[model samples]
Target: MRKLQFIILLQFSILLFAQENEMKWQEKQYPDSLEAVNKAPENHIILFENENLRLLKIFVAAQKSEPIHSHRWPAVMWVYQPSDYEQVFYTENEKAERIPVQTVAMKKNELPMNVGFPVGKGDLGLSKNLGNQDLVAYRLDFKKKIDSSKKITKPTGWTWNEDLDGVKKAPASHQIVFEDEYTRILHVVLSKGEEESVHTHQNPCLFWVVKSQPIEYSEFKMDKKGKLRKSKTHQLPPLPTDQLLDQNKISDPEPPHSVKNLGTENFEAYRIEFKK
Candidate 1:
Protein backbone atom coordinates (compact mmCIF):
# COMPACT_ATOMS: atom_id res chain seq x y z
CA MET A 1 0.00 0.00 0.00
CA ARG A 2 2.87 2.36 0.90
CA LYS A 3 4.59 1.74 -2.48
CA LEU A 4 1.33 2.35 -4.40
CA GLN A 5 0.69 5.63 -2.60
CA PHE A 6 4.25 6.79 -3.38
CA ILE A 7 3.83 5.98 -7.07
CA ILE A 8 0.59 7.95 -7.26
CA LEU A 9 2.19 10.97 -5.62
CA LEU A 10 5.06 10.87 -8.10
CA GLN A 11 2.61 10.88 -11.02
CA PHE A 12 0.77 13.86 -9.60
CA SER A 13 4.00 15.78 -9.23
CA ILE A 14 4.96 15.09 -12.78
CA LEU A 15 1.59 16.30 -14.03
CA LEU A 16 1.91 19.57 -12.16
CA PHE A 17 5.38 20.18 -13.56
CA ALA A 18 4.25 19.50 -17.09
CA GLN A 19 1.28 21.82 -16.77
CA GLU A 20 3.46 24.64 -15.39
CA ASN A 21 5.85 24.38 -18.30
CA GLU A 22 3.02 24.15 -20.79
CA MET A 23 1.57 27.45 -19.60
CA LYS A 24 4.72 29.44 -20.41
CA TRP A 25 4.40 31.75 -23.41
CA GLN A 26 6.62 30.76 -26.29
CA GLU A 27 6.99 31.84 -29.89
CA LYS A 28 5.38 28.63 -31.11
CA GLN A 29 3.10 27.61 -28.26
CA TYR A 30 0.75 30.63 -27.91
CA PRO A 31 -1.97 32.02 -30.16
CA ASP A 32 -3.46 35.49 -30.61
CA SER A 33 -6.78 34.34 -29.19
CA LEU A 34 -5.32 34.35 -25.68
CA GLU A 35 -4.58 38.09 -25.67
CA ALA A 36 -6.33 40.25 -23.12
CA VAL A 37 -8.23 42.24 -25.74
CA ASN A 38 -9.55 39.04 -27.28
CA LYS A 39 -10.22 37.26 -24.01
CA ALA A 40 -11.56 40.23 -22.01
CA PRO A 41 -12.91 42.68 -24.53
CA GLU A 42 -15.13 44.55 -22.09
CA ASN A 43 -12.20 45.91 -20.09
CA HIS A 44 -9.35 45.71 -22.55
CA ILE A 45 -9.82 48.09 -25.48
CA ILE A 46 -7.44 47.73 -28.38
CA LEU A 47 -6.46 51.12 -29.74
CA PHE A 48 -3.87 50.08 -32.29
CA GLU A 49 -2.01 46.92 -33.24
CA ASN A 50 0.72 45.76 -35.56
CA GLU A 51 3.36 43.06 -35.75
CA ASN A 52 5.58 44.88 -33.28
CA LEU A 53 3.19 46.57 -30.84
CA ARG A 54 -0.36 46.54 -29.53
CA LEU A 55 -1.73 49.53 -27.65
CA LEU A 56 -4.56 48.79 -25.24
CA LYS A 57 -6.64 50.93 -22.94
CA ILE A 58 -7.68 49.12 -19.73
CA PHE A 59 -10.63 50.25 -17.65
CA VAL A 60 -11.94 48.54 -14.51
CA ALA A 61 -14.48 50.29 -12.37
CA ALA A 62 -14.60 50.26 -8.58
CA GLN A 63 -15.68 47.04 -6.92
CA LYS A 64 -15.30 45.32 -10.29
CA SER A 65 -12.89 42.87 -11.86
CA GLU A 66 -11.60 41.97 -15.28
CA PRO A 67 -12.24 38.49 -16.60
CA ILE A 68 -9.40 35.95 -16.71
CA HIS A 69 -7.01 36.92 -19.46
CA SER A 70 -3.41 36.54 -20.62
CA HIS A 71 -0.89 39.05 -21.89
CA ARG A 72 1.40 36.80 -23.86
CA TRP A 73 4.13 39.34 -24.42
CA PRO A 74 6.24 41.64 -22.32
CA ALA A 75 4.64 45.05 -21.69
CA VAL A 76 4.85 48.43 -20.08
CA MET A 77 1.68 49.82 -18.51
CA TRP A 78 1.22 53.56 -17.90
CA VAL A 79 -1.62 54.18 -15.53
CA TYR A 80 -3.12 57.65 -15.79
CA GLN A 81 -6.03 56.88 -13.49
CA PRO A 82 -5.31 54.34 -10.76
CA SER A 83 -7.07 52.49 -7.95
CA ASP A 84 -6.26 49.96 -5.26
CA TYR A 85 -6.52 46.40 -6.54
CA GLU A 86 -5.70 42.73 -5.97
CA GLN A 87 -4.31 40.22 -8.44
CA VAL A 88 -5.42 36.61 -8.84
CA PHE A 89 -3.31 34.26 -10.96
CA TYR A 90 -4.80 30.96 -12.04
CA THR A 91 -2.83 27.77 -11.72
CA GLU A 92 -2.59 24.86 -14.12
CA ASN A 93 -5.02 22.72 -12.10
CA GLU A 94 -7.56 25.59 -12.04
CA LYS A 95 -6.54 26.63 -8.53
CA ALA A 96 -6.52 30.31 -7.60
CA GLU A 97 -3.39 32.07 -6.28
CA ARG A 98 -4.38 35.41 -4.85
CA ILE A 99 -1.77 38.14 -4.57
CA PRO A 100 -1.87 40.68 -1.81
CA VAL A 101 -3.89 43.84 -2.30
CA GLN A 102 -1.99 46.73 -3.82
CA THR A 103 -3.01 50.37 -3.60
CA VAL A 104 -2.43 52.66 -6.58
CA ALA A 105 -3.40 56.30 -6.81
CA MET A 106 -2.55 58.99 -9.37
CA LYS A 107 -2.41 62.73 -8.94
CA LYS A 108 -2.95 65.25 -11.72
CA ASN A 109 0.14 67.28 -10.92
CA GLU A 110 2.22 64.15 -10.50
CA LEU A 111 3.17 61.37 -12.87
CA PRO A 112 1.18 58.16 -13.10
CA MET A 113 2.05 54.68 -11.80
CA ASN A 114 4.36 53.23 -14.40
CA VAL A 115 4.85 49.43 -14.41
CA GLY A 116 6.83 46.87 -16.40
CA PHE A 117 5.60 43.30 -16.93
CA PRO A 118 7.84 40.48 -18.14
CA VAL A 119 6.70 37.54 -20.19
CA GLY A 120 5.44 34.74 -17.95
CA LYS A 121 3.24 31.69 -17.94
CA GLY A 122 -0.10 32.16 -19.68
CA ASP A 123 -1.93 31.42 -16.44
CA LEU A 124 -2.89 35.09 -16.17
CA GLY A 125 -6.09 36.14 -14.49
CA LEU A 126 -8.23 39.10 -13.42
CA SER A 127 -7.44 42.16 -11.37
CA LYS A 128 -10.01 43.03 -8.73
CA ASN A 129 -10.22 46.71 -7.89
CA LEU A 130 -10.58 47.14 -4.15
CA GLY A 131 -10.81 50.91 -4.03
CA ASN A 132 -13.78 53.09 -4.94
CA GLN A 133 -12.02 54.95 -7.75
CA ASP A 134 -11.94 53.65 -11.29
CA LEU A 135 -8.73 52.11 -12.62
CA VAL A 136 -7.79 53.27 -16.11
CA ALA A 137 -4.45 52.67 -17.73
CA TYR A 138 -2.74 52.33 -21.12
CA ARG A 139 -0.88 49.09 -21.79
CA LEU A 140 1.65 48.72 -24.59
CA ASP A 141 2.52 45.15 -25.47
CA PHE A 142 5.73 44.18 -27.19
CA LYS A 143 4.52 41.63 -29.71
CA LYS A 144 8.02 40.47 -30.60
CA LYS A 145 11.28 39.89 -28.82
CA ILE A 146 12.99 43.19 -28.03
CA ASP A 147 16.67 43.12 -28.82
CA SER A 148 18.77 43.45 -25.70
CA SER A 149 21.73 44.69 -27.71
CA LYS A 150 19.82 47.93 -28.39
CA LYS A 151 19.19 48.77 -24.76
CA ILE A 152 19.80 52.41 -23.87
CA THR A 153 22.09 52.98 -20.93
CA LYS A 154 20.59 55.49 -18.55
CA PRO A 155 21.97 58.91 -19.44
CA THR A 156 24.17 60.64 -16.88
CA GLY A 157 21.41 63.09 -15.92
CA TRP A 158 18.19 61.05 -16.12
CA THR A 159 16.04 62.24 -13.22
CA TRP A 160 12.42 62.76 -12.24
CA ASN A 161 12.72 66.55 -11.98
CA GLU A 162 15.03 66.95 -14.98
CA ASP A 163 15.57 65.06 -18.20
CA LEU A 164 18.95 65.36 -19.86
CA ASP A 165 17.95 63.26 -22.88
CA GLY A 166 18.75 64.95 -26.17
CA VAL A 167 15.18 64.43 -27.32
CA LYS A 168 13.84 66.16 -24.22
CA LYS A 169 16.15 69.16 -23.96
CA ALA A 170 13.40 71.34 -22.59
CA PRO A 171 12.55 71.77 -18.92
CA ALA A 172 10.96 69.09 -16.79
CA SER A 173 7.76 69.16 -18.81
CA HIS A 174 8.86 66.25 -20.97
CA GLN A 175 10.20 63.23 -19.04
CA ILE A 176 10.69 59.52 -19.03
CA VAL A 177 7.96 57.64 -17.19
CA PHE A 178 9.73 54.27 -17.26
CA GLU A 179 12.48 52.52 -19.19
CA ASP A 180 13.38 48.85 -19.60
CA GLU A 181 15.03 46.67 -22.21
CA TYR A 182 11.66 46.13 -23.84
CA THR A 183 10.22 49.68 -23.98
CA ARG A 184 10.40 53.33 -23.03
CA ILE A 185 7.42 55.46 -22.01
CA LEU A 186 7.58 59.26 -22.05
CA HIS A 187 5.28 61.95 -20.72
CA VAL A 188 5.01 65.44 -22.21
CA VAL A 189 2.97 68.41 -21.05
CA LEU A 190 3.09 71.94 -22.39
CA SER A 191 1.05 74.75 -20.93
CA LYS A 192 -0.23 77.81 -22.79
CA GLY A 193 2.49 80.10 -24.16
CA GLU A 194 5.05 77.42 -23.32
CA GLU A 195 7.39 76.00 -25.91
CA GLU A 196 9.56 72.87 -26.05
CA SER A 197 13.22 72.98 -26.86
CA VAL A 198 14.29 72.00 -30.35
CA HIS A 199 14.54 68.20 -30.30
CA THR A 200 13.66 65.14 -32.37
CA HIS A 201 12.67 61.57 -31.64
CA GLN A 202 15.55 59.12 -31.69
CA ASN A 203 13.25 56.12 -32.16
CA PRO A 204 9.98 55.35 -33.85
CA CYS A 205 7.33 56.57 -31.42
CA LEU A 206 3.62 55.78 -30.97
CA PHE A 207 1.89 58.77 -29.33
CA TRP A 208 -1.50 58.99 -27.61
CA VAL A 209 -3.24 62.06 -26.31
CA VAL A 210 -3.96 61.70 -22.59
CA LYS A 211 -5.47 65.08 -21.71
CA SER A 212 -6.61 67.79 -24.09
CA GLN A 213 -9.63 69.67 -25.40
CA PRO A 214 -10.80 70.14 -29.00
CA ILE A 215 -10.14 73.87 -28.98
CA GLU A 216 -6.57 73.68 -27.62
CA TYR A 217 -4.07 75.40 -29.89
CA SER A 218 -0.69 74.00 -30.95
CA GLU A 219 1.78 73.94 -33.85
CA PHE A 220 4.94 72.02 -34.80
CA LYS A 221 7.28 73.14 -37.53
CA MET A 222 10.94 73.37 -38.40
CA ASP A 223 13.15 75.42 -36.12
CA LYS A 224 16.74 76.63 -36.46
CA LYS A 225 18.68 76.52 -33.22
CA GLY A 226 16.43 78.40 -30.76
CA LYS A 227 14.78 80.55 -33.45
CA LEU A 228 11.29 80.10 -34.98
CA ARG A 229 10.04 81.49 -38.28
CA LYS A 230 7.47 83.68 -36.49
CA SER A 231 4.75 83.38 -39.13
CA LYS A 232 5.88 80.03 -40.48
CA THR A 233 4.34 78.17 -37.53
CA HIS A 234 2.10 75.52 -39.07
CA GLN A 235 -0.86 75.08 -36.73
CA LEU A 236 -1.63 71.50 -35.67
CA PRO A 237 -5.28 70.91 -34.84
CA PRO A 238 -5.48 68.94 -31.61
CA LEU A 239 -6.63 65.37 -32.15
CA PRO A 240 -9.62 64.34 -30.06
CA THR A 241 -8.82 63.13 -26.57
CA ASP A 242 -8.19 59.41 -25.94
CA GLN A 243 -7.13 58.84 -29.53
CA LEU A 244 -3.98 57.20 -30.85
CA LEU A 245 -1.87 59.41 -33.10
CA ASP A 246 -0.09 57.27 -35.66
CA GLN A 247 3.42 57.77 -36.96
CA ASN A 248 5.28 56.10 -39.77
CA LYS A 249 8.38 53.90 -39.96
CA ILE A 250 10.32 52.00 -37.30
CA SER A 251 13.59 52.85 -39.00
CA ASP A 252 12.63 56.51 -39.42
CA PRO A 253 12.55 59.11 -36.64
CA GLU A 254 11.00 62.57 -36.43
CA PRO A 255 12.95 65.62 -37.53
CA PRO A 256 14.23 68.00 -34.87
CA HIS A 257 11.80 70.83 -34.05
CA SER A 258 10.07 72.82 -31.33
CA VAL A 259 6.44 73.06 -30.15
CA LYS A 260 4.81 76.17 -28.66
CA ASN A 261 1.42 75.76 -27.02
CA LEU A 262 -0.88 78.64 -27.91
CA GLY A 263 -4.02 77.56 -26.10
CA THR A 264 -5.67 77.63 -22.65
CA GLU A 265 -5.50 73.89 -21.91
CA ASN A 266 -2.26 72.06 -21.41
CA PHE A 267 -1.04 69.69 -24.12
CA GLU A 268 -0.46 66.22 -22.70
CA ALA A 269 0.31 62.82 -24.19
CA TYR A 270 2.24 59.56 -23.72
CA ARG A 271 4.91 58.51 -26.18
CA ILE A 272 6.03 54.88 -26.41
CA GLU A 273 9.41 54.42 -28.07
CA PHE A 274 11.72 51.52 -28.75
CA LYS A 275 15.49 51.34 -28.83
CA LYS A 276 15.55 48.77 -31.59
Candidate 2:
Protein backbone atom coordinates (compact mmCIF):
# COMPACT_ATOMS: atom_id res chain seq x y z
CA MET A 1 0.00 0.00 0.00
CA ARG A 2 2.80 2.42 0.82
CA LYS A 3 4.54 1.61 -2.44
CA LEU A 4 1.39 2.30 -4.44
CA GLN A 5 0.86 5.61 -2.66
CA PHE A 6 4.44 6.64 -3.37
CA ILE A 7 4.06 5.91 -7.05
CA ILE A 8 0.86 7.91 -7.22
CA LEU A 9 2.51 10.83 -5.48
CA LEU A 10 5.46 10.72 -7.81
CA GLN A 11 3.17 10.67 -10.86
CA PHE A 12 1.25 13.70 -9.61
CA SER A 13 4.46 15.64 -9.08
CA ILE A 14 5.71 14.75 -12.54
CA LEU A 15 2.42 15.88 -14.05
CA LEU A 16 2.75 19.24 -12.30
CA PHE A 17 6.27 19.75 -13.54
CA ALA A 18 5.29 18.89 -17.10
CA GLN A 19 2.39 21.33 -17.03
CA GLU A 20 4.62 24.10 -15.79
CA ASN A 21 7.13 23.51 -18.56
CA GLU A 22 4.45 23.30 -21.24
CA MET A 23 2.96 26.62 -20.16
CA LYS A 24 6.34 28.28 -20.31
CA TRP A 25 6.89 26.92 -23.80
CA GLN A 26 3.42 27.96 -24.87
CA GLU A 27 4.06 31.55 -23.84
CA LYS A 28 7.47 31.67 -25.47
CA GLN A 29 6.21 30.29 -28.75
CA TYR A 30 3.20 32.60 -28.80
CA PRO A 31 4.18 35.68 -26.87
CA ASP A 32 1.57 38.34 -26.10
CA SER A 33 2.99 40.75 -28.68
CA LEU A 34 2.46 38.21 -31.45
CA GLU A 35 -0.98 37.18 -30.30
CA ALA A 36 -4.23 37.85 -32.13
CA VAL A 37 -4.54 41.48 -31.13
CA ASN A 38 -1.15 42.42 -32.49
CA LYS A 39 -0.94 39.86 -35.26
CA ALA A 40 -4.28 40.95 -36.66
CA PRO A 41 -4.59 44.33 -35.01
CA GLU A 42 -7.71 45.44 -36.83
CA ASN A 43 -9.84 42.46 -35.86
CA HIS A 44 -8.83 41.09 -32.47
CA ILE A 45 -8.79 43.82 -29.84
CA ILE A 46 -7.33 43.58 -26.38
CA LEU A 47 -9.96 44.41 -23.76
CA PHE A 48 -7.85 44.08 -20.64
CA GLU A 49 -4.92 42.17 -19.13
CA ASN A 50 -3.35 41.53 -15.74
CA GLU A 51 -1.12 38.86 -14.21
CA ASN A 52 -4.12 36.62 -13.67
CA LEU A 53 -5.92 36.91 -17.02
CA ARG A 54 -6.47 38.76 -20.29
CA LEU A 55 -9.71 39.63 -22.03
CA LEU A 56 -10.19 40.51 -25.68
CA LYS A 57 -12.79 40.73 -28.41
CA ILE A 58 -12.79 39.69 -32.05
CA PHE A 59 -14.63 41.70 -34.63
CA VAL A 60 -14.92 40.40 -38.18
CA ALA A 61 -17.22 42.03 -40.64
CA ALA A 62 -19.41 40.08 -43.00
CA GLN A 63 -17.52 37.77 -45.34
CA LYS A 64 -14.25 39.16 -44.06
CA SER A 65 -11.25 37.34 -42.61
CA GLU A 66 -8.82 38.43 -39.97
CA PRO A 67 -5.15 37.89 -40.74
CA ILE A 68 -3.62 34.56 -39.89
CA HIS A 69 -2.70 34.85 -36.23
CA SER A 70 -2.34 32.90 -33.00
CA HIS A 71 -3.78 33.15 -29.50
CA ARG A 72 -1.28 31.61 -27.06
CA TRP A 73 -3.64 30.61 -24.32
CA PRO A 74 -6.89 28.64 -24.46
CA ALA A 75 -10.08 30.61 -23.74
CA VAL A 76 -13.63 30.27 -22.53
CA MET A 77 -15.50 32.28 -25.17
CA TRP A 78 -19.06 33.46 -24.75
CA VAL A 79 -21.98 33.50 -27.19
CA TYR A 80 -21.46 36.48 -29.46
CA GLN A 81 -23.39 39.61 -30.28
CA PRO A 82 -25.97 38.75 -32.94
CA SER A 83 -25.08 35.19 -31.99
CA ASP A 84 -26.46 33.36 -34.99
CA TYR A 85 -23.95 33.11 -37.85
CA GLU A 86 -21.43 31.06 -39.75
CA GLN A 87 -17.66 31.19 -39.24
CA VAL A 88 -14.78 29.24 -40.71
CA PHE A 89 -11.36 29.04 -39.09
CA TYR A 90 -8.42 27.74 -41.15
CA THR A 91 -5.80 26.44 -38.80
CA GLU A 92 -2.59 24.40 -38.41
CA ASN A 93 0.14 26.85 -39.54
CA GLU A 94 -0.25 26.36 -43.29
CA LYS A 95 -4.03 26.50 -42.78
CA ALA A 96 -4.16 22.81 -43.77
CA GLU A 97 -6.70 22.13 -41.06
CA ARG A 98 -9.62 23.72 -42.86
CA ILE A 99 -12.61 23.92 -40.57
CA PRO A 100 -16.06 23.52 -41.98
CA VAL A 101 -18.19 26.58 -41.51
CA GLN A 102 -20.66 25.78 -38.77
CA THR A 103 -23.87 27.59 -37.96
CA VAL A 104 -23.64 29.08 -34.46
CA ALA A 105 -27.23 29.46 -33.32
CA MET A 106 -28.80 31.31 -30.42
CA LYS A 107 -32.32 32.35 -29.49
CA LYS A 108 -33.27 36.02 -29.48
CA ASN A 109 -31.62 37.83 -26.56
CA GLU A 110 -29.97 34.61 -25.45
CA LEU A 111 -26.60 34.98 -23.75
CA PRO A 112 -24.84 31.80 -24.86
CA MET A 113 -22.27 31.57 -22.09
CA ASN A 114 -20.03 28.48 -22.26
CA VAL A 115 -16.73 27.07 -21.02
CA GLY A 116 -13.60 25.06 -21.99
CA PHE A 117 -13.02 26.24 -25.54
CA PRO A 118 -11.27 28.29 -28.30
CA VAL A 119 -8.91 25.34 -28.28
CA GLY A 120 -6.23 23.88 -30.56
CA LYS A 121 -3.09 26.03 -30.32
CA GLY A 122 -4.60 29.21 -31.69
CA ASP A 123 -7.71 27.88 -33.51
CA LEU A 124 -4.43 27.44 -35.42
CA GLY A 125 -4.94 30.21 -38.06
CA LEU A 126 -7.15 32.96 -39.49
CA SER A 127 -10.89 33.37 -39.06
CA LYS A 128 -13.47 34.22 -41.70
CA ASN A 129 -16.93 35.39 -40.82
CA LEU A 130 -19.21 33.76 -43.38
CA GLY A 131 -22.27 35.77 -42.44
CA ASN A 132 -23.79 39.16 -43.27
CA GLN A 133 -24.02 40.73 -39.84
CA ASP A 134 -20.92 42.02 -38.11
CA LEU A 135 -19.53 39.33 -35.80
CA VAL A 136 -18.40 40.11 -32.26
CA ALA A 137 -17.33 37.77 -29.49
CA TYR A 138 -15.47 38.09 -26.21
CA ARG A 139 -12.57 35.76 -25.44
CA LEU A 140 -10.96 35.43 -22.03
CA ASP A 141 -7.51 33.94 -21.44
CA PHE A 142 -6.41 32.57 -18.09
CA LYS A 143 -2.74 33.50 -17.61
CA LYS A 144 -1.98 32.19 -14.14
CA LYS A 145 -0.69 28.66 -13.92
CA ILE A 146 -3.27 26.17 -12.66
CA ASP A 147 -2.18 24.81 -9.32
CA SER A 148 -3.37 21.39 -8.16
CA SER A 149 -3.35 21.98 -4.42
CA LYS A 150 -4.82 25.38 -3.59
CA LYS A 151 -8.07 25.84 -1.68
CA ILE A 152 -10.42 28.26 0.04
CA THR A 153 -11.96 27.47 3.38
CA LYS A 154 -15.58 26.93 2.35
CA PRO A 155 -17.88 29.25 4.24
CA THR A 156 -21.09 28.10 5.90
CA GLY A 157 -23.13 31.30 6.24
CA TRP A 158 -23.24 35.10 6.43
CA THR A 159 -21.69 37.53 8.92
CA TRP A 160 -21.05 41.27 8.95
CA ASN A 161 -18.00 41.86 6.71
CA GLU A 162 -17.41 38.17 7.20
CA ASP A 163 -19.19 35.32 5.48
CA LEU A 164 -22.01 36.23 2.96
CA ASP A 165 -20.00 34.69 0.13
CA GLY A 166 -21.00 35.41 -3.47
CA VAL A 167 -21.33 31.89 -4.84
CA LYS A 168 -22.89 30.44 -1.71
CA LYS A 169 -25.55 33.12 -1.28
CA ALA A 170 -26.16 33.96 -4.95
CA PRO A 171 -25.52 30.94 -7.09
CA ALA A 172 -28.07 31.68 -9.81
CA SER A 173 -26.43 34.79 -11.21
CA HIS A 174 -22.84 34.09 -10.28
CA GLN A 175 -22.76 30.74 -12.06
CA ILE A 176 -19.41 29.02 -11.73
CA VAL A 177 -18.52 27.51 -15.09
CA PHE A 178 -14.99 26.41 -14.21
CA GLU A 179 -12.94 26.07 -11.04
CA ASP A 180 -9.48 24.76 -10.26
CA GLU A 181 -7.05 25.00 -7.37
CA TYR A 182 -5.77 28.34 -8.68
CA THR A 183 -8.98 30.10 -9.69
CA ARG A 184 -12.78 30.11 -9.59
CA ILE A 185 -14.42 31.54 -12.69
CA LEU A 186 -18.06 32.54 -12.67
CA HIS A 187 -20.25 33.34 -15.67
CA VAL A 188 -22.34 36.04 -14.09
CA VAL A 189 -25.54 37.18 -15.78
CA LEU A 190 -28.30 39.58 -14.94
CA SER A 191 -31.36 40.24 -17.04
CA LYS A 192 -32.45 43.80 -17.66
CA GLY A 193 -33.77 45.45 -14.51
CA GLU A 194 -32.93 42.36 -12.46
CA GLU A 195 -31.30 42.72 -9.07
CA GLU A 196 -29.24 40.15 -7.18
CA SER A 197 -29.77 39.33 -3.51
CA VAL A 198 -27.07 40.84 -1.29
CA HIS A 199 -23.81 38.87 -1.09
CA THR A 200 -20.09 39.42 -0.52
CA HIS A 201 -16.97 38.45 -2.42
CA GLN A 202 -14.07 37.74 -0.08
CA ASN A 203 -11.25 37.49 -2.62
CA PRO A 204 -9.80 40.01 -5.01
CA CYS A 205 -11.13 39.41 -8.50
CA LEU A 206 -10.30 40.09 -12.14
CA PHE A 207 -13.31 40.79 -14.33
CA TRP A 208 -13.88 40.34 -18.04
CA VAL A 209 -16.77 42.53 -19.02
CA VAL A 210 -18.61 40.45 -21.62
CA LYS A 211 -21.68 42.65 -21.88
CA SER A 212 -21.48 46.43 -22.00
CA GLN A 213 -24.36 47.92 -20.04
CA PRO A 214 -25.10 50.13 -17.06
CA ILE A 215 -25.43 48.91 -13.46
CA GLU A 216 -26.35 50.09 -9.95
CA TYR A 217 -24.36 48.63 -7.07
CA SER A 218 -25.37 48.90 -3.42
CA GLU A 219 -23.58 47.73 -0.27
CA PHE A 220 -25.33 46.94 2.97
CA LYS A 221 -25.08 45.60 6.50
CA MET A 222 -26.79 42.41 7.70
CA ASP A 223 -28.04 41.91 11.22
CA LYS A 224 -28.00 38.56 13.07
CA LYS A 225 -31.41 37.63 11.63
CA GLY A 226 -30.16 38.75 8.21
CA LYS A 227 -32.33 41.85 8.00
CA LEU A 228 -30.58 44.62 6.06
CA ARG A 229 -29.56 47.85 7.74
CA LYS A 230 -28.67 51.22 6.25
CA SER A 231 -26.44 50.96 3.21
CA LYS A 232 -24.55 52.89 0.55
CA THR A 233 -24.94 52.69 -3.20
CA HIS A 234 -23.05 53.70 -6.33
CA GLN A 235 -23.47 53.59 -10.09
CA LEU A 236 -20.96 51.65 -12.10
CA PRO A 237 -20.23 52.36 -15.75
CA PRO A 238 -21.70 50.24 -18.52
CA LEU A 239 -19.47 47.15 -18.48
CA PRO A 240 -16.37 46.66 -20.62
CA THR A 241 -16.18 50.34 -19.65
CA ASP A 242 -14.81 51.33 -23.05
CA GLN A 243 -12.85 49.99 -25.96
CA LEU A 244 -9.88 50.75 -23.71
CA LEU A 245 -8.84 47.94 -21.35
CA ASP A 246 -8.01 50.34 -18.53
CA GLN A 247 -11.62 51.48 -18.50
CA ASN A 248 -12.82 48.21 -17.04
CA LYS A 249 -12.26 47.86 -13.30
CA ILE A 250 -11.53 44.91 -11.01
CA SER A 251 -12.91 44.20 -7.54
CA ASP A 252 -11.44 43.70 -4.06
CA PRO A 253 -13.20 42.37 -0.98
CA GLU A 254 -16.23 44.52 -0.26
CA PRO A 255 -19.12 44.58 2.16
CA PRO A 256 -22.33 42.61 1.57
CA HIS A 257 -24.06 44.09 -1.45
CA SER A 258 -26.34 43.69 -4.41
CA VAL A 259 -25.84 44.58 -8.08
CA LYS A 260 -28.71 45.50 -10.35
CA ASN A 261 -28.66 45.65 -14.11
CA LEU A 262 -29.79 49.07 -15.25
CA GLY A 263 -29.58 48.57 -18.96
CA THR A 264 -31.85 47.60 -21.80
CA GLU A 265 -29.84 44.49 -22.53
CA ASN A 266 -28.78 41.62 -20.35
CA PHE A 267 -25.59 42.19 -18.37
CA GLU A 268 -22.85 39.59 -18.56
CA ALA A 269 -19.35 39.34 -17.09
CA TYR A 270 -16.68 36.76 -16.41
CA ARG A 271 -15.64 37.07 -12.77
CA ILE A 272 -12.27 35.40 -12.06
CA GLU A 273 -11.47 35.12 -8.36
CA PHE A 274 -7.89 34.23 -7.49
CA LYS A 275 -7.57 31.64 -4.73
CA LYS A 276 -3.86 32.20 -4.06
**Alpha-carbon RMSD of each model:** 11.8, 9.5
Q: Count clashes in each candidate, considering only residues at least 3 apart in sequence or on different chains.
A: 0, 0
Best by TM-score: 1
* Colliding residue pairs in candidate 1: none
Please write out the lDDT profile of model 2 over residues 1-276, one tens digit for every residue: 875565445345434533543543343354465578778888877777777677677787876777766667655554345433443433233333444322223332332334323332334355566556777766678676656576554344524454478888887788876565666677789999999988888766666666777899897876689688647889987854424433455655556789999999988876667676
Q: For candidate 2, what is the TM-score?
A: 0.64
Model 2 pairs whose backbones collide: none
Query: Which regions in candidate 1 have their CA more than 4 angstroms from the true location?
Result: 1-34, 94-112, 115-121, 148-167, 214-231, 247-252
Off-target runs (Cα >4 Å) in candidate 2 are 1-34, 82-112, 118-123, 142-144, 147-163, 208-214, 223-227, 235-250
Local accuracy by lDDT, each model: 0.61, 0.62
* Candidate 1 lDDT tens digits, 1-276: 875565445345434543553444232333467568888898998777889778788998998988767777656566677787765654332243433222223333232354333333444567787778888888777677767677544344322222324345764566776676555778778877777775656556677777763332223443477443433346676676666665432323444456767677887877777675
